[model samples]
Target: MFTGIVEEIGTVEAVEPGTDANGVVTDARLRVRGPLVTSDARPGDSIAVSGVCLTVTDLPGDGTFTADVMPETLRRTALGELGTGGRVNLERALAVGGRYGGHVVQGHVDGVGTVLSRTPGPRWDEVEIGLDPALARYVAEKGSITVSGVSLTVTRVGDDSFGVSLIPTTLAVTTLGSLAPGARVNLEVDVLAKYTERLLATAGSAGTAR
Candidate 1:
């Protein structure tokens, strides 16, 4: 599990084939090895690579690690569009006694959203993302949402979009600063809201059956 807090901005160094002889172009395989992320890493350790929870498959020397990207993961989220030299938000799993600065984030991206607008202001910038209709219900004004592994509060919600305020610190530390309109981003809504919705729906159905 993660806290939706970005630890570092890492770059995709290389992408290689996952197989040798039975070489079929499946999903895009990648090896995103970066410093500060693999300082104490090992195999099976969970790391949020741009809001996607990927396990460490291999650990090469000099702070380098590998993880596989399947076709389903590629199509479901925005990790497929990454190429060599692309910057990505990275965060390690929450430790047992670590401070929970951000909300609970499973690092499982629910869907991909498109960047609608990024308006720069005097103090901060307001970023609007065109979210999916299905996920729109979970987003509310002042609710927390993880965009590309960075936890941000929704300042406003429209019919199919939501806005977030980004301070100068956030802009300098995360990949969101470089995002342009129409770029795709991974989104993970608040998990607790989904459970609440399910319970309410189930109770309503049960009551009507009487």
Candidate 2:
């Protein structure tokens, strides 16, 4: 599990697409340079690469680590659009008894969202992002949401979009500060909300059957 706390901004070193004998793309391998995350990273450690939990496959000992991205991950996330030299938010898995800075984050991207607008304030920027209809129910005003590995609170929510306020620290530290309108980002809603929904649905079904 992850805490949606971005440790550092890593650059994509390389992207190698895997193709089968029939020339069909099967998967992609990524080499990312994150000095802090790789400081103690082992071959089997889990790392969150821009909100996607990827297993560390190799450590080239040059502050770079490799992870294989399956086809399903590419189809569900913005990672497929990443190219060499692209900057991505990176975080190591939460250690036991560590300070819980952000909310519960699974490092699992639920869907991709687009930047719709950005309203700049003197101290912070209010950014609105388009949300998928299926995931809309999980978002609530003041609720927590993870956008490209940065945990942020929902300031305002609409039927098709949600807004978040990014402070100066967030703007200077993570990839969200550089996002422009129409840019795509990986999104993960609060997992507690999902579990609550599931429990409520099961209860309703039981009542109906009784």
Candidate 3:
């Protein structure tokens, strides 16, 4: 589990495509350079790379670690588009008794969203991100959403999009500041909303059976 707080901006060192016996690419291995995150890292540690939870497969002792990305993960998130020299938001797994800076984040990219527009303010930037209509029900105004591994509050919510305010600190620290219109980002809606929906559905089904 994670808290959706980005600890560092890591660089992709290499991406090795994994192929099958038939030479069909099925997965990818990514080596990312994050000095802070890799300092105490060991093989099998879970790290959130751009909102995607990946297990550390190897540590090369060079401030870099490797993880494998499955084909389904590539199809569902924007990590597949990442290449060498790409910047990615990185976060180590939440430690026991750690400060909960952000909301509960499973590091599971629910879906991919596109940056619709950016409205700059004197103090911050209000960014509108296009969302899938099916996922709209899970999002609410003033609720929390994780975008590219950074947790942010939804300032406004629409049927097909939502807005978030990025402060100067966020703009300076994470990769979100460089996002352009039409840029793809991994989005994870509030997990609490999903859990509530599931519980309500289960209760309704039980009432129906009675």
Candidate 4:
């Protein structure tokens, strides 16, 4: 599991085809090349690459690592479209004693969202994203949402969209600063909300049957 806290901004070095014959799955070699993240990384360790939980397949020296992207993961997340030199948010798995700086995140992208607008103010910027209809119910005002592996609070929510405010520190340290309107981003809604909704739905059905 992850905490949706971005540690570094990594770059894609290479992308090769995986064992899948349909050209759907891919193997990505990323170059974060940072000591704090790569020093103890081993095969099968989970790392959040731009909000997607990818297992390390190989750890090449010089700060580089490799992970395989499955076909379903490619279709459900935004990692499949990455090209060489593309920048991505990176975070290692949260340790047992690590501070919970952000909300709980699975590093699993539920779906992809598109940037709808960016309103810049004197001290902060408000980013709005159009989310998928199926995931819309999980978003709420003041709720937590992970976008591109960065945990952010939902400033506002609409029928099919949500907004997040970004401070200067967030802009400087993560890949969100470079996002423009219409750009695609990986989105993971709060897991608690999803579970709550399921329980409520089941209870409502049970009540109606009585």
Q: What's the best-to-worst order under TM-score? A: 2, 3, 1, 4
lDDT of each: 0.88, 0.96, 0.95, 0.87
lDDT, candidate 1, at 44: 91
Model 3 residue 198 CA deviation in Å: 0.4
Q: Residues 8-70, candidate 4: write the lDDT tens digits.
A: 888888877565477644554444444557788998898899999988888876788888777
Please, what are the lDDT tens digits per residue for candidate 2 over residues 69-183?
Answer: 9999999999999999999999999999998999999988999999999999999999999989889899999999999999999999898899999999999999998999999
How far in Å is the alpha carbon of 111 misplaced in model 1?
0.9
Q: After superposition, how far is residue 152 of candidate 2 from its true place, in Å?
A: 0.2
Q: What is the TM-score of each candidate against the true structure?
A: 0.94, 0.98, 0.98, 0.92
Clashing pairs in 1: none
Higher TM-score: candidate 1 or 4? 1
Candidate numbers sorted by lDDT from highest down? 2, 3, 1, 4
Q: How close is candidate 2 to the true structure, as a TM-score?
A: 0.98
Candidate 3 residue-wise lDDT, 28-53, digit = tens: 99999999999999999999999999
Q: Among all windows of ten consecutive residues in candidate 1, which has the lowest summed lDDT?
A: 17-26
As a TM-score, model 1 comes out at 0.94
TM-score of predicted structure 4? 0.92
The CA-based lDDT of model 3 is what?
0.95
